[model samples]
Target: MRDGPAPGASAPTQTDMDLDLAPSPPRVEDLIAARRAKRQAILAKYSNGTSSTSTPVASQSSQAPLPALLIAEQSITRANSVAMSVDGTPAPEKYSQGERRASMSNSPPPLSAQDTAGDIGADLDKLDAADNLAFELAKGDEQDGMQAPDQETISKLEGGHDQISAADYDPSRDRREDEHKRLLGEVPHKPKVEDVMEIEEIEDVEEEDVDDMFAVAMGEPSKKTKKVKKTVSKPAPVLITTTALLDTAADAEGYYSVILGEQIDGGRYQVVSSLGKGMFANVVRGLVLQSPPEAEGILGAEVGKEVAIKIVRSQESMYRAGLKEAQILQKIRQADPDDKKHLVRLERTFEHRGHLCLVFESMSMNLRDVVKRFGKDVGLNISAVRTYAHQLFLALSLLKKLNIMHADIKPDNILVNERKNLLKLCDLGSASDASENDITPYLVSRFYRAPEIILGVPYDPALDIWSVGCTLYELYTGKILFPGRSNNQMLLLMMELKGRFNTKMIKKAKFQDAYFDEMGGFESVERDKVTGADVIRKIHLAKPTRDLRARLMPPTSVKMNDNEAKLLTSFIDLLDKCLALDPSRRITPREALSHPFIRG
Candidate 1:
């Protein structure tokens, strides 16, 4: 009928005809019936404890068989057995066909185009039921003190099934439920606010041990509260020394009350004698009980050695200042490890009872004490002045090289050893970098303060030279060269000795308006004692009454020989260079060291 066949083609056979006339596709109802039959056979085999073969219907078309259903049916049967074994009871009878059919018809349609989508969904649902049944079996095994199935066995069971939808099966659901139950059992009861407040109040009461009467006597506020019902009786004030009255507790201003002969810093240092007290800190003589290993070559290391302990007030500002001083001291120590630079050495530092303590080498006395003891009103001998001046200039040279400024360089801040041979500079708490500007004008003592400071002009290391000149004069004459009660009076005294300041210097002064008129003439304000009213006074400059050399060698003083007179002349010349009115004209520490007075 179609031209017989090609040359190589065989004639049409019965089998070929049968293949060409393919049977119609299997109906949906038929596929459903076969699935139900297969599930029933699987259930019956498990129920009767016998092997039963299930011959699934084969589609005559190209559609693939659904092996997922057989796997789901086997899983369901195994789950039933697991349940029965766990509870020691038979599983319920297999679901009736009518019920199964109704459930299949009522289920939501699959969203995918695969013919087996519905079967896959049903298999997933049954797999979830099997998982739930397995969880119950695991719990039962745990209760019976039996080893449950390992993770490997469970993984095998999971691998046997098809990829199930995440919505239909969640392996972590049972674990999450168990965790929730455990967390509920372990929950702690919340404490009430009243209970918390009561506990805090108890702690506060326990910590309030300061004596109320002593606090009031010291002008400090009492920490006792109304809630503290216990009455504390006042005790007698404990007197530690004849001149020193010790407080029982810290003052409101954060000053730690000290007891004489008491040990501090874990008994490493013992308080022996009070050295002195300043605005920022107090100094006391301490006996070292424990010497640090690093203090091998440093002074104040051996046990029983006397060291000056400067305890900074516990106030926040003082603490920060103390830290800065310690840092500067450390920098100096590193720079002068040989200790040849005539600078006080800081041995170490520590904190005791919220106060910072700096340990320094103990010296016998300061230059003020030296002057008071040896010089009296007449001042130290010329030979002694030369020796002290040389050492002080050396210290200044070191400071200049380091770019440091000793803001407060008075006689009281320079110390000498017990031998009275070596002089060392101390009390650098007010020191700052020389390159820094914006420094306070009220630096150095009133007598030794530089003219630049009085004019409120930016200062440099030359400021220290001016102070050294004043100190040397005091050391030589046993008298303050310029002792002015007020800053305005000080300027007048300076002009009386050094003559009026240059007009250019006055123009550069930040406080020029206060001390000088717009015409560059000296003007000062004063309080009239009679009326207690401000009075503006204008000063007229005059030639110095006596030159520096004439002042140094007064007629009342003993006459010096020719050699001594020549030495005195050189000393006066050096002082003139140091006490220059303009900072730029002032002699440097190095130049001062090479001066004829210092070299001679």
Candidate 2:
């Protein structure tokens, strides 16, 4: 009688809404499981590679050593500043700026941390003691020179393109390992342009970098007028207003998608030089047909044009997630009305093969190459410093207010439009949002990391000021502020230059224990935990602050004349605050931007 229960009677149910249902159709379950599997595969494909995801953990007791000196020489290329002359011909360049001569001011060399350099007397001893005791002990015997490596081991090392087997280990090896590495993947793969002796088309190129790089750099009135060429077509009509364009594209989270490389406008475009390559993509210089072809998504206005193409290197469809980011960025054109002056404008975006191509207004050159080639032009002089620093400050001020930090600010990231006397920041690959939660980034290039970032402390936009300081230093002094060998090496240099940080700043960092233990090395260790304010202690960097005082050396000013052993000093001053370990106490971008040295 209960089996059929009353037809319309309510069925008894468990209090908490317990219920039972008929088994699902196997086909439906299979379809759902298949969809889920597909979704998981897509997710796995878009995930970031292990390359930079984890915080680097070093063993406390280990002292691994760097491979033998793999120093690569810089190439001296005389590429044209203007892609084409007004008459529609490729422009030719001659000398680069640093190769030019300049008058300088003289000052006694500041007290150096090391008394000796070239001789490698105490320095080599220190380098020997620094780390990698195993390599050091074997490489330098009592006489200081290690024995030559045997040929069999060399053959073993060179013969295999893969990892060296354990048996190949021989303390007897000297130059063999280095030669093997050089033969493998190291630079100097291409020699310095000067080493070529003779160039194919250009005649009698110089060995050293010259003061005036482009033909127009020479003071004499050139018979030829600067021809503004109109070869590259105007960028697409889409508008973008951010002072920074690529910030939205770079992922701080461990998420990455492959770039799909599709030929823009079918095969009508021809590939040229390579701009750069990332693990996931290849940025190449390309020329597209100016005329329209019967194609979909081809913006009629940009039918024939030259542009930089960034194509993802992977073959998987999951790269669509990364392309989605590019697509979103491509449509963006809005910028704060007031901040437009500081923002770089986006021209057009088109899709090819699944990959997206973004077009931007071409620039003459980045500040790094300029400084490498034309630093003398910026001068060790006060007026030149004012002009260059002023422009940089203007750019920083505008960028800071937008809550966008140029995380990868470096000489290489700054682009100069010589004709306009304007500087635009480029390379958003490492840029990040200000509101992001995971703040400790190893993202900035090796040489430009701020002290806080280096120490694994929570970082903010102030890191940019540190880079600006580094840039300012390089601009005036023609030297790198912290050309460290590794992340630890960089922090060591900062500690050596600016002293140790106090407790609070130390506490905020990811690895405070190791750093805290080392604080005893400083002169003033009161035995208290380091605070944010204590980042800079009594130990100070070599200085001639404010006016030239003893020698009238001012921040950002060239102190001595060339005949007097020229010195650029003010930049050294910025390094003090720029290197300050506390984020709260560190100079803000606006404050650094308004500093007298950068002010005209």
Clash pairs, model 1 backbone: 379-478
Q: What is the lDDT of residue 415 in candidate 2?
A: 66
Ten-residue region with minimum lDDT total, candidate 1:
137-146
Error of 1 at 42 (Å): 99
Task: Write the residue-wise lDDT of candidate 2 on 188-260 in tens digits.
Answer: 1112233322212222323221322323332334222222111211222332221212322323321223233
TM-score of each: 0.57, 0.46
In candidate 1, residue 153 scores what lDDT? 37
- For model 1, residues 151-197, the per-residue Cα lDDT tens digits are 23323443521111111222233323322333233221222333322
**Cα shift from native, residue 36, model 1 (Å):** 99
What global local distance difference test value does model 2 have? 0.41
